[model samples]
Target: MNSQVFQTPIEYLKGVGTARAEVLKKDLGIFKYEDLLRHFPFKYIDRTRFYKIRDINPELPHVQVVARLTHKEILGEKHTKRLIVHAQDDTGVMELAWFQGIKWAEKNLVIGKAYIIFGKPGMFNGKAQMAHPEIEPYSPEALKGKGNVSLQPGYNSTEKLKTFSLDSKGLQKLVAILLDQFAREISEILPQYLLQKLNLMSRVDAYRNIHFPENATLLYEAQRRLKFEELFLIQLRLLKSKLLRTQKFKGNIFGSVGQCFNTFYHDKIPFPLTNAQKRVLKEIRLDTQRGVQMNRLLQGDVGSGKTVVALMSMLLAIDNGFQTCIMAPTEILANQHFISIKQLLGDDFVEVALLTGSVKKKDRKIIHENLENGKLKILIGTHALIEDAVQFQNLGFVVIDEQHRFGVEQRAKLWRKNTIPPHVLVMTATPIPRTLAMTLYGDLDVSVIDELPAGRKPIETLHFYESQRLQMFGLIKREITLGRQVYVVYPLIQESEKLDLKNLMDGYETMSREFPLPQYRLSVVHGKIPAADKAFEMQRFVKGDTQIMVATTVIEVGVNVPNASVMIIENAERFGLSQLHQLRGRVGRGAEQSYCILMSGGKLSREGRIRLDTMVRTNNGFEISEIDLQLRGPGNIEGTQQSGVLDLKLADLATDQEILLQARKIVEDIFARDPQLALPEHQVLHYAFASKNAGLSWDKIS
Candidate 1:
């Protein structure tokens, strides 16, 4: 495996000179050859054969045609260099129009000459026409319809690069240079046995085929191999990091059985803790008291008493003469935490303060002074608590709510606040698939609150078609009349015919007219609204002051309105399963029989139908997550299409669950026998593993 870095800048790459490099660097963030090598295409184009002009469909975006040039004419005003050529085959005749590149195109389009043209066909002057189609001079054999382009690579380039004559084919030629020159040095990256068993193509071969495939099977194979490699690297990185943290690092151990927890359990709280809560508390107590830093993920379904458990854990820290800080992703959530903890620990002798980005200067100064002086024993805030200005006297424990919103860097920053890394507890309401959890958070220990609190009923979820709009509105009216608030959510802010559904603004207006709350007040919230305004509107619903709240997914994460027993998701099919679960969670937090009405306005795709059906069939977040994983795959779970979280080349995170389990077993055995993969039989694997991690800042494959 080649571990050496390529230091050459992009300009020095075979075809991209200084001018082309300038365009790439300025427009696409490509400053080096390495960047170009890693810039994977978003999509591909297939040009197997060209169709006759008469067979063209104006509605289609991509089309190919082959015909002979029968006539050529330059028309339009002096300022317009429009060249029009009439071409025809046995089927029909069509016009070829080139607006500016007349001289060059005309020279290539001689009368009686045959050529192949590839581009979108359109209607002009009530006839078929192709504008600036990619033209290729015909060969005698190709003119007979025998030639075919099995696959064509389309490189992602900006307009500036295109105008400069640098297109997909041009970029492909440059990459070919890199691959050809480095073939020998690019030692195979995976073990020979695993590669053969998985039927994955070699890295060198995969790269070539990804850009220029000889057949459909090869293309599929190439894509599968690349996806698997990416995913494998990610899993390896996560597992390796986890091993490093647990095996190499030490943490402050907290004892498992303590009088503080026992006393609080029997004397302090008014109600008994739920079984799930007790189980999670025990796990946290063990992890924190193990004398090693606790990096654990606490996953709970909606209304599973997660907050109470979090509060209990924080109390344990406080009892140990250590200060605890809890961070929520939003100001509203932070404020909610402040109030909940203060109320939960009423007269328990723990100081708590709320710090947010919007804190007034005077209040900020007071909080800052208190935090620095250790007077603020427990702090609850948004990202403001992470700012350097905020100091803790003895920050022993850290709790992060809605942990998915914070990235690795942000969590690390908070973890560094104490002299010793604080016992960290991260919580998330979004239930992730087991495979995804393993890959995304392999470094952290996980705790699942699988059961809801005692006496709590599951929220009833239903799906409604657009035709049932009137009935759904009536249901909401009845629910509001029954003293329960309702949330009407829209996926968009304005009407977009491209996406068949009511936008937030349009829905707000229509809802205002239909569900006229003359006797009841209503509030509106969306992304474009100011945060302060959104927070205020959310407060209205939270306080039971607003009868209905027309909102977007903005409230999908933090806002908790127990009294809002009804959730009417407009265009519910547009939302993902996990998102729907989160929104449904907003309700069902109280002791009410909450209902989630999923309303979709148009025909749902198979996946969309599955999402809505899953929501209606079950209220368990874990089940919904498995459905989501099966439908959407793990591409965007890390939030970005280009994220490097699961950089697998051959493995399918969703479908190959059994394969992953087998691989885990194999990895464990192999490590036990030869920890560094130093055996002769594992040489292929060692090279493959090292090859995958070569040149990467952090090893993707553990």
Candidate 2:
């Protein structure tokens, strides 16, 4: 490409001036000629087939017609006035109306003259009508010049941009001007061999057809080429990061499976490891032993025994004469992990300590001393572990639970603790879809423990309407009588006029009335409650002192009570699929058959029904995640929306998996043949990669 021509500011364009350039930049992020060139249309409309007046229907998305205007009039008073025009074909007549721009339409439209009209067809008062339709003077020469193309590109514009005459049509006109002037300046970025092997279109032709195609076949080819390049560049950058990290950063060599790991595996383990768990462990072992810094993401569903795998990985570090730490997002989670790890060690001799903001000043001093003196082999805590005062003697491995909750800079702090950054294993209970895993954590290796431990049964999920409240209450009572606890979760802390869902306080009051205090004890927790009070309530529930625990989603993570056999989510339709799944996982921890009762009103939206049906259908987290990705696009998924890496203009992770996989495979093959891109044919590829990644620093990290 001619860099100077492409990088020219938008104001320099023939039609766009300073005022319009500011609006374009602010509304659409179009600053330079290149930015406008890459802005592909969202959809296309067929304009080749002109519809007759009698054939127009509301079911049709849009229609184009060339007809003669015979009648024109203005109706109603100010604020209610509208321009009404009648256009007639040989078969019938249709009404053309405009309310906002009536003056412009009344002056510009010529009666008794032919016009080409295009817009969405609708019906008003049992007659065919079009509101604010596009009108152009009919000319045979203009039609011939357009070549009668079937597809017309439609761009997206904001209301602010529309005020500056930058609507879809305006944007399309600007794109056409740029293409006509600088189409020859656009250069190909892909190599000739790869293009021929893939049968891809040229870069310049793709850009032209993407904005203004002569035919549908050419449009399809243009889309294919552009989507491939977008995904290929992303995959190339990620894979290159992984390659460079492996070659540049040397890791601590854990040469042997020493006594600590062996002892825990043989004796201290409470249950046998599942095949999935073993597989993940093997991957981690290989990564650490290869003498390269390990950055792996461990994805497992709730109660899938990921904690055990994390602990065992830490033990491997201990056997290599190094210290390790586990960081959690919340204090409650950190405390729970500390307790679980302690219980799992049983009679083992590995030293472990808990550190958090709640730890006293004197106690923190002792923990600090032990950490620096190398007495603390393992430390489990919240963000306190990343403090500069909490230095380590020789930290070799680190485990981060719920890794998405922490920012990139926070994780980098742990990396700086050691002269040579420790091997990092970031864990998440929220299962990520395959495509998302490739894009979000592409720089890190991924291992999944896809199976639950033995003796655990899948939770039986049930949906209930408000009319069936009594039946749900009866079931809860039966479970409590059977020596099992219950969890009652509400969506909100207090009542809101906008939403008709039950709140936590109201539900707690009703529960207190339904089951008297002397007969039944209930603990309540929500975000508004004090930290100490929340912990007290949680402790009471954990100890089985309370027969029911009514809380908010704050208990969604970190709380594990085996005896809690029933989970009742009030207004279940208000929660997301992933959140509902996490709440369902709170139960079914014990050998007994557990139940998750989804309580909602009688009416449900389409999306709400799908979410509930999916919960009742399967217990597979991976399957649920895929469905979630389909329902809500990649931008709406939990952690990825803020990453800024998913700002893709053409390729979609939800429906373009095939293209993504092919792009990844092609990128891998290219790297295998030419790691440095030093081949004569790969010069274009190297320059493109370098230009795309200019001034980026994240590639140096995980």
Candidate 3:
């Protein structure tokens, strides 16, 4: 088997000239011979059962029959013309028709000749017929040949490809040609010993059976082998990247827990740290002590005390004589962090400053000067912190809040701020399912703070329909009467003619009418509002100046008002699970019990109902995330759609967790026993890795 053949342009393959090749490349991304080979079937139709013409019904999915073309004719004018052929078996008669490819059908059909037909059955004016069915001359010897299976592989193709005779059936023919000519040239990538241990099919047999399986058992085995191989390669690559980083990068060792960390942990802390928080801090400490640049993903549910853990990690860096910074996705979050951290470190001997786009020139100049001269110990800001003028004296550690909001390239800028790339701890409030975490952040060590801080109550979630609006209003009024503020969130800021939703403006007006202005003050905030105005409203709500704050999802991440005890989400079914969870998190910050009221219309879709039910059933973010993955799939998850590793063809992240775990385990075992994969038995794996990542470098910190 030669690698060069796989790399050959797809246009050079037999039966695929330049015209068809361009269509394949443009539509399906099949530019090379190997790409075509890897384009697996989406489904397979069983052709083994031949149905009698009398038994065919419109309800049947697809059926195959052996019949003869008794009569053929062309009917209608130019655009409406069609070729109709009457076919009959010993039992009954059926009609075969073609509208688009009339000329080809007329030229190919032989009158009174027996043929095998396969297609979906349909009813047309009380007669059974098949539209544009696949017709092949009947041959008993071909059907009886060894290794010939009665399963027909179905592929995905665009309408444009159908015009050029590259539909599913045409594509299947081309694949058969490729396999007939070059199936033997396909190389076996896995070692023989591993294949024997796993009892997996050989590479060539797997490829052949995948497209044209001999039987149901062979197809199952083929799919299993290919899925295992794909996941194995991805896990192996990520593990290798992590190993290479540890071997190549040298981190500044933070070997001491000095006055700053010890004081904050023992005396200045407001409450006792949860066991989850302590565990995460210990993991970060070990990474910093190992002298290897740490790339860790800190996952915690909303209100899980991730910020305290982040601040403590920063204190550890400051204790070891290094400046630290925390980068947030939005200015509101940055301001919140700045204010909260300042209050937590009250009267402590640590200097902190905030830098953002809205800061005045004078303040920016002083902040920049202090940062460059080692006067500022901790800097908290948004994207402005990565500006060229902002230089650090010794930036040893960095924390990214809501890491998914920032692009990978933007995050990389912070890494270059120091001579030695600083240790990175990217924190996210959105819980990632275990399988997604393994694939998306496999190159980085992971830590999860799975519990909330002390005195925090699990938010009580409730579902209400449009008819229950009065009940919801009564609850809000009661909460406001108890000296608690309320947040009323809407999905859409403006009214859409296409969607029947309760917009923000309409909700605000209703609230104003329900609780009049003189006694009940209501604040409004949305994305369209000016930044200063939005800040003013947010501040008023935080200070309990307003009894009700009407807003949109922009308040999902930033607002942390402790006195806000109620979250009423209008059109709650319109939002995703993670977003609903985040909005629910806006409350339950105080020791008092909190409630999240989900209001939806009478007409609820199944998926929408599941989302709301899941929210009401559990406050655990991890449990909600797993259900979210199953419902919406991995591609729609917050940060994983753009990851290159998620471009899986044969494996599904939601349903294939068992296979993924097995692949990861095997990869780990291989690396533990043979670091370099230098043994003779593993040469095949080494070669596959080299060929797969020929021009790529695994040096970036994820």
Q: Residues 518-625, candidate 1: write the lDDT tens digits.
A: 676889998888988988888878888888899888888777777888999988989988889889888887787989999986777899988998899998899888
Q: State which candidate has the highest TM-score.
A: 2
TM-score-wise, the better of 1 and 3 is 3
Q: Relative to the true structure, how large is the alpha-carbon lDDT of every model?
A: 0.77, 0.90, 0.89
TM-score of each: 0.76, 0.95, 0.94
Error of 2 at 547 (Å): 1.7
**Best candidate per lDDT, number?**
2
Candidate 2: tens digits of C-alpha lDDT, residues 57-113:
899999999999999999999999999999998988899999998989999999999
Candidate structures ordered by TM-score, highest first: 2, 3, 1
Q: What would the C-alpha RMSD of candidate 2 be, to one decimal place?
A: 2.7
